[model samples]
Target: MSLGKKLKQLRKEYKYSQAVVARDIEVSQQAYSFYENDKKKPTMPVIARLARLYQIPMSELLNAEENTKEQQMEKFIEVLTRRIWAIIDLKYLNNNFFDLCLVIEEQARISLMSVQSREILEKKEFDLDYTTLGKLRGDYLEPFKEEIENKNQDTELIPNLVETIFLKEKEIASKYFE
Candidate 1:
């Protein structure tokens, strides 16, 4: 099903009105209606928020289907590259350090696709070298992995970055919905 239909089904299943879901996500009722109508696409941030709100994974919220290795790599690169650029933009904006960390986590999740792709390439007894596999992981993947581990647990800032970005994304989502 399309994301909008899925969202509407979930909302109805959960017994939530558009206003209720919108208020929970800090958006207007009309905006939520637009989202349900598939008149607009949510940004990564809003999609993330919806995933959390719906208590599901981001991929599930996006209605993303599993694909063959080639397709997966393409998607992995798309998400990974966008995250890399998001980190650079955050740095330029002087956003919090946790913003970078969150972007890194996002990248790492995308990088998991490489492991799947490698397995497919090897066709059984995977014997890929570290360097070759690392290259396949892409430049940003390692840094993201390292930062995710190194990120401070006390700050509780990274989780908030998703919400902060979502609020901004809601505006863009609204335009698409319209």
Candidate 2:
């Protein structure tokens, strides 16, 4: 599946026509058509607008075809779990809740890395560095620790967790590209 095919599939799934998507993203119909045809790539701003219009994460739109089936499934499960947790207001649970959340978060990361590693190996034909993956996994796992600690200690730690996650992701990405 190419990016263009993914875009077309998403558009159809969302019940959107080229003209409607173009109008929503403030691009001319021809330009949007070109994007769908893979004849031209959209600017970052246009991509952002399209992502917003489609109510999807920017990465979903940008890396749609690149993601493996396992990665996609893991992402879907994570999103669904989060939504269910939010809807049920699970945050009000006691100390045990924090522990449960921590466990879930850890499992989610392990699942994510497993999917990502499988995708890389299957599609890219390379043996990824397990040490790097382990380091990145630690980096990814730290936020859950912070979240649990914040809940337990009554401190504002979400910002720090997010920053740490971003830095770790960057580090992991650099290693992969190297």
Candidate 3:
């Protein structure tokens, strides 16, 4: 997929509005919308913050498929049905990502659209949805658990999946660690 498409998919997977992503990356919602629609590419700093905010590696955020060898790296990629089953099972049983979001929400970066940004989008007549963001938090996470756990039909190693989800979640909650 193109980087823009990949970015859009990631934002949806995480259930964020353009304003939310922009705020997290410290950019205007218009700029973020441009990035998603491929009107422009984001700068390296913006890309880094985006990768960090979305809990994904820079390569995966950029969809660096050309780096196939790097993508196939053993540590970053693993079979879905293998030893990492432990991690899968943990995610399946415990959907704590939203709670993690709640706990660190103030300190951590966020991407929800403010009223002003919503007005701007409306004025611009863009079709992006900024509503229901607060509601989508825990609700959107459950349906994904089983699908993610079972996504191993081809058995290829998926690269940096954890960077976008698992490890990033852990990193967000690190202050609670003992």
Candidate 3, residues 43-126, lDDT tens digits: the string is 999999999997878977666324343332221223211323444345432444454334323212222121012343455432
lDDT of 2: 0.56
Question: What's the lDDT for candidate 1?
Answer: 0.51
How many times do residue backbones clash in model 1?
A: 3
> What's the CA error at residue 26 for candidate 3, in Å?
0.5
TM-score of each predicted structure versus truth: 0.36, 0.41, 0.39
- lDDT, model 3, position 129: 24
Instruction: Give the best candidate by TM-score.
Output: 2
After superposition, the stretches of candidate 3 with alpha carbons farther than 4 Å from their true spots are 64-178
Candidate 2's C-alpha runs over 4 A off are 74-178
lDDT of 3 at 167: 42
Clashes of 3: 5
Per-residue lDDT, model 2, residue 38, is: 89
Per-residue lDDT of model 2, residues 26-139, tens digit only: 999999999988898888999899888768788877886677665555453544355334422444234243444444444444433432433444454333444335545554
Overall lDDT per candidate, in order of appearance: 0.51, 0.56, 0.49
